[model samples]
Target: MLARIFINRPVLACVFSIVILLLGGISAGLLPVAEYPEVTPPIVRVTAYYPGANALVLADTVAAPIEQQVNGVEKMLYMTSQSNNDGSYTLDVTFAIGTNTNMAQVLVQNRVAIAEPSLPDVVRAIGVTTKKRAADILLAISLDSDVNPATGKPYYDALYMSNFATIQLKDAVSRLEGVGDVFIMGQQDYSMRVWLDPDKLASRNLTVTEVIKVLREQNVQVAAGQVGQPPASRGQDFQYTLSTLGRLIEPKQFDDIVLNTDKNGEITYLKDVSRNTLGAKSEDIMSRLDRRASSGVAVYLLPGANALDTADGIKAKMRELEPRFPPGLKYAIVYDTTPFVRESVHEVQKTLLDAIILVTIVILVFLQDWRSLLLPVIGVLVSLVGTFAVMKVMGFTLNNLTLFGLVLAIGIVVDDAIVVLENIERWMEKGLAAREATMKAMEEITGPIVAITLVLSSVLLPSTALGGLVGQFFRQFAVTISVSMLISAVNAMTMTPALAVLFFRNRKPGKHAEDKEALPWWGFGLLGGLATVWLLTPILGPSLGLTTGEGHGESAPGGLGASLAGLGATLVLAFPGAVGGGVLGWFMVRPVNWTLGFFFRGFNWVFDWATRVYGQIVGWCLRFSAVVLFVYVGLIVLTGFGFSRIPTGFIPMQDKGYLVTNIQLPDSASLERTLEVTDAVEKIALETPGVAHTLCLPG
Candidate 1:
């Protein structure tokens, strides 16, 4: 079957190669590249605050009812809730790891029906997370007074500057490519904190609730209907519609806000009792840069945004806006995530290159011929290039796992090429012409190679249908390996045979000119002896030596019989000691590290003592031979168990990025506080050379 392929399908093979190459290139351009997929789906969190409820009470009234109603969801994991002393209840429902969040959310809402009527009306608003909390580091924002001359102070510190900056910065960041949302926090603006005198409130017959209600009502802005527009004045032959609304621009507006009437029938306005003022809100202490009071803002990039480019864009914008900041204040980016991504990619690529070179050198050394090396090399290249195209078509990313798969598969792919090439070489060395050799090689090895490839691919094909985070992490790797292996098989069947027929005649296995060399006398003698052993062993039932009942008389004390008996006894006795030493060594492995460190400090002393001991026993031939043989046997035993002791992993870690950071914080910490701590740590991170972005989240 394969001989026909080698004989007649050369043109088809060439055409297929061209088509695969083009398709792969196109796929490479279009595939999405990410660190990992979104293995975790949408998680909805509901939090309710009850100022005086205990944990037990909160659990029974608020948590239990919600759980029962939200139970029995098809794709839901479970709903878990916790209560605290402050009377807050937070219920978290985690869906099945990869379930579609949008669909699951609808099902969850419908299930919560039975519990809705039992809740206390006093329970504050239930907060549901509409979007997933992302860990993506989008853009880093910095403000510098030195760069923008028109600005008076750090916008982050200046109340007016911060107010205007928030509006402008938020607007600009939204325009950048791949930006999901922009959040600006940490700037405090003017707020009226009414520190009312209890006595004054009693005397005025006013309650706290009444004051709050009037205050809220006075701060309102309502939209009125649009003012009338003339048809003749409107553009494009149509009348335009414009809505009118009242705007509150200053704190003085509150002074004229009317309250309820006094006993004397005069209107009691806000100006009657409390003094109106504009001052900074009652916020926590302001932070600083270089000990000068300053504020900072952060920008989170969209999930799919390229970290490097987004960071560059932010830095460029800062350069343009620096001149607008205040004097004595400076701004700088504390951390960015781009450099880390770049470094990780570079390290993986470098290791891959080194692996390729090593594989090539190995092929050359083992084949010991140029043509044999070329076919497998070409096969490897074709397989890898084809894999890239498949990845592009499948929208897979070039991540750590995927690259690792490629590295591992590189060795296995060469196995097929080697099998085909070796078989063809064997035929050629037997004096077959190139065409005949190619046909014979394919005919003999094609089935085995295809079967092996299929077996390997089947082992990994199940990964594509796996569930949860583990599946998302490993699926791409499995795909890469399976694809590469299949391509290699194709290459072996097609390109390898084709190349062999074209180049085999010119590249003979050895340099000797003789067409046939006669087998040597020793070779024939060895073959005859092996044949004799095979034919006799089966007939004689594997008996090389037999203890026959032909002992005539009792042997003398010093004869051969006594010596053989002593030898057997000695061998039997030595087994126990050898086995005991091995068990002792196995148990002592834990102490080896500390012991080696100790002896390394005194290695010279130990070596000198051993040398003197060896000198004293140099002429003892029996002792020397026994010691050498014992040491060799001990080594062979230890070698057998070496694999069990050493730590085994899929692959050895390449020396590249080891920059992993772990952070911990107490529970109930707000996002604002978390960002504050993260910012401080980021300063230290950015100050260190080669340190890329710092990522932080609440535990």
Candidate 2:
């Protein structure tokens, strides 16, 4: 019924296809691209700092109380905590892979709130930091300085860079779209370091602790009360608040801080015991870029934020912020995940396009007419464009998995077009008019087309129900393929028949086509199978590396061999693989057409024998159905056993032109010790073959 409506008006089909094409084109640009589906388990971190405590003390005093409260966070899978001898503690609560992190975070935050009262006063004053961790770092930016030609020293030291990054860069970057948090790494905030001399303290008859106490007391910040009365009647006199700039700002201010008032009417100020100098806080982190001392910031993306957008936004922000930076310092992207994502996506797209062109060329080869290629071309184009539109609506991103799904969709979409158009072309070659041929083709193919759609959907749809990370990842793939196949089925019935009816009405029979009947079902089964495999070569082709002229004899300079190799490639290169393949039977036939025919003849002969043998086996199986069932069960068990021996992972690793390596030294290692190991590892990586560079992450 639906096919008849579309067959009557081919114009409507064309309009529908154009609309979908437009929608897909627009959505492709707007869709957020990422490296992987959101498969990482959600993590919420709870942290506290208790000054002057060791790791054991910190764990017992801070980490333990917090973990005890946050242990039962809803949807949480497990919790892990770390305590550092520097008096810092971090409790990390990890939820299930697919849990809604926002809700999980809220639940954990509530629990942590209850435990905050039990924390030490120092820890409480420092504030317990609780947050849901953002997705992986989108970009890492390093702020480095160049040596001044005017001065022997570099423009600014590490302390200046650290303060500038914290105050300037972090805020600018965090304001960008999709950015969750911009963490300033390897930065001990600017501070005044009071270097007290034990010798000076003893001579002054004061303890080192007494000196520290005097300095701390002198740096107190307080809000003083107003000196004037309230303005109950209109202000009779000007009012002012009694306040003092209590906290010391400059190094000179500490000189007046009294360390003690001795027996005599005399005071010993801070300068008597120690010299105060401007510096940064105690160093707990070390960051380096290519062996240069530096500081950096790591930008992260919020959940569901477009990674491509966030990465690009970060770079754009850095560019805008770079100019205002201090003399000789500039921001450079030290690490980025987006480039790999963009390149992989581009490769997959190029492959998909190649496959489509190759399929079209194969259609042209078998049918020997461009008009016969029309319906199949429209089917593929419509299905692909429409799939993107659906993806946007489904909130699916363009990642490796969805791209994989789209790549697989090529075969399904083409298969349907092949059935519809091939049948119509065969009937048309038999001298029937276009309408009569389409009618007859539809009559024979309609039921099978519908059934094929159902079978394909059944095969693919179950994957969407997968319960784990792999299931979430490939759901896009499974849904895409399932949806695309169903779409292809619809197009085959409606648009394909419409196009055949419209185009075939004016067609003239080919001279060779009149002399013989087209290949029968089994003949097409043999030939069509070969054509499909041949068409898949461009997409399935191995990636090759470029060679320099150093090895072996002089290069076999490009000539006819390269040209002919590229001839089929020209189509795929232009329209990409699948599109260019339609140009010729010669393209597929290559140096020897007859050899292909010879191979085809051999295949037919082999298939004939296999079929006869299979028919006999089927008859025997029918007679002994119980034994056949038992044999099938035995094979299933054997297959499971064989598969069990093979190693498995959620998805195979792909070389996306990037590598992420993580190393942890002993838990008790200090920041300096960590950098020692990191530099050693970085040196080894740089010395290794094919390794271009390495970035040691901030400690």
Candidate 3:
């Protein structure tokens, strides 16, 4: 048996656990942290612009043709399109939840290519591009400005602020590790606009189209061949290259372009008809922060990159750029999804750690010796660490799914080690030597231990075998539990036995070990009451999820309100559980104990009678064997149909703490009006006992 193999090489077992722990720790750092496993359907968006077209025109001319071509693309679940009065078209194509997004995008692109010729000329000129859209943002950094400390200048205009961000900040943030793209919001590029006076143009006998054509023609640059030393062999005289600066780089150059000359000797220049100035391209978006013109970089994370690492990398890059920023320009974190991701992951991690603590206490309570808790605790730690290496190998993240699975697996993993240790202790209590007890215990219990591990594996591994996105969500949880179990099984056969023998050897038995007496009536009552309290305390915190899907009657408020509410709830619950538990203990002293004891004996009597009755029923069925067989087969068939007709849910949908608080104002509420409402809310919140802060984010 494998137990024999491991028992022979106890040092190897110790080394194995140590090595796995080291590797798993390293893998934990490497694994990505995300909010959820990718469960949402991947979406590809196609955008087009038609400068002067209305929404109806854009829908009919720009959106219709593209949607027709992209509709039947591979794995596409559905397509939706929208047209705006500003002459923009957005066609969103959602693919199957687990579709290969890159390939799907390419397919949509090729189809959009086929529709290109059908679109209007202006739409084609403006160009249509596809972008992969994730449901949630990764991070967003605000480009805010401060009053110059030295110069006393106000914040710059939105146009200049956006250009500086696009030119200096966008590329820097984009190059950070794990960042997919950093798109500048409210961005406007440098451009030139020529103010056309229709009266002057009419006086000049020129039209807007003619001016455009003349400018386009005059803006051209021509290249002449270079001349050096008369072709190096033919000409005798040294020659310098002839050159001309043909491109227009100034407003004077543009105005000086000759459009036409009057036959009556009155010459007209382009400057007489129009005025040109350097300015920003037209912009439709306005970003603001602290009542100043603001800009931001919307950072997208790579598909499976570590979010915390990505966020930290971006903030680090931002810090490096901050010192070099232009005077009056500063940066702020407007929004970052990473903090929530970090909190949730850490919360689940804390839950697991708390679980370990809880299990340790319970183990100590049961064993009554700290030394006996070591093997089980060691087994749990080793199994958990070892599972991380497996997670890294399998490309699983340390998200809610995997972490919750580990939380559930704690009991199973510690159970294996606890069982093996308890068996060794039992064998020693039979008056056998430590080594003999270890060997004898393993011989008797190893098969059953292995069987139980296999049985647990059988239950978990099937969830991994399920198909589609739901299956993918469960895959990490199931695989994690399965790997932890396998590790625990190995530890049970090796580490537990080895540690038991090593520690128990040469150890003297205590008085309780030699002669243990049953607990008296009062002692049993006290123990039972304490167990009830122990069970009730932990349940109180998480039981918030079970109260009609809301916490504390109303949805829990954000910030300190939630904390205060939870504390109040614990106090409220614990008071009753404590008082009633004590009362229960007192009542169970004698009369209650007799009643419980009698009831349990009656339960045992019912079970014994059932066993005897089953035998008699079996004999009667044997007399009508054919009829009984038919009836049993019919019941099995009925159960099969019953199971088939049962309704299924993917999983229990917990609140996940994504509560949105809506603040409403009058229908025609201006920005100031909305801020008034916000201020009023904050004022009330400030007056409240536990609330300390409030945040308002406008959509």
Candidate 2 Cα lDDT to native: 0.74
Candidate 2 weakest lDDT stretch, 10 residues: 545-554
Query: What's the TM for model 3?
Result: 0.68
Rank the candidate models, highest TM-score first: 2, 3, 1
Backbone clashes in each candidate structure, one number apiece?
12, 15, 0
Comparison by lDDT, 1 against 2, better one: 2
**Tens-digit lDDT string for candidate 1 (612-664):** 88887775745689887888899988997996788876335654333546556
Native-structure RMSD, model 1? 23.7
In candidate 2, residue 295 scores what lDDT? 81
Clashes of 1: 12
Q: Candidate 2 has what TM-score?
A: 0.74
Q: For candidate 2, write residues 400-442 as lDDT tens digits.
A: 8788888888888888988888787778778787787788888
The positional error of residue 17 in candidate 2, measured at the CA in angstroms, is: 4.1
lDDT of 1 at 164: 45
Best by TM-score: 2
Q: Each model's TM-score, in the order given?
A: 0.60, 0.74, 0.68
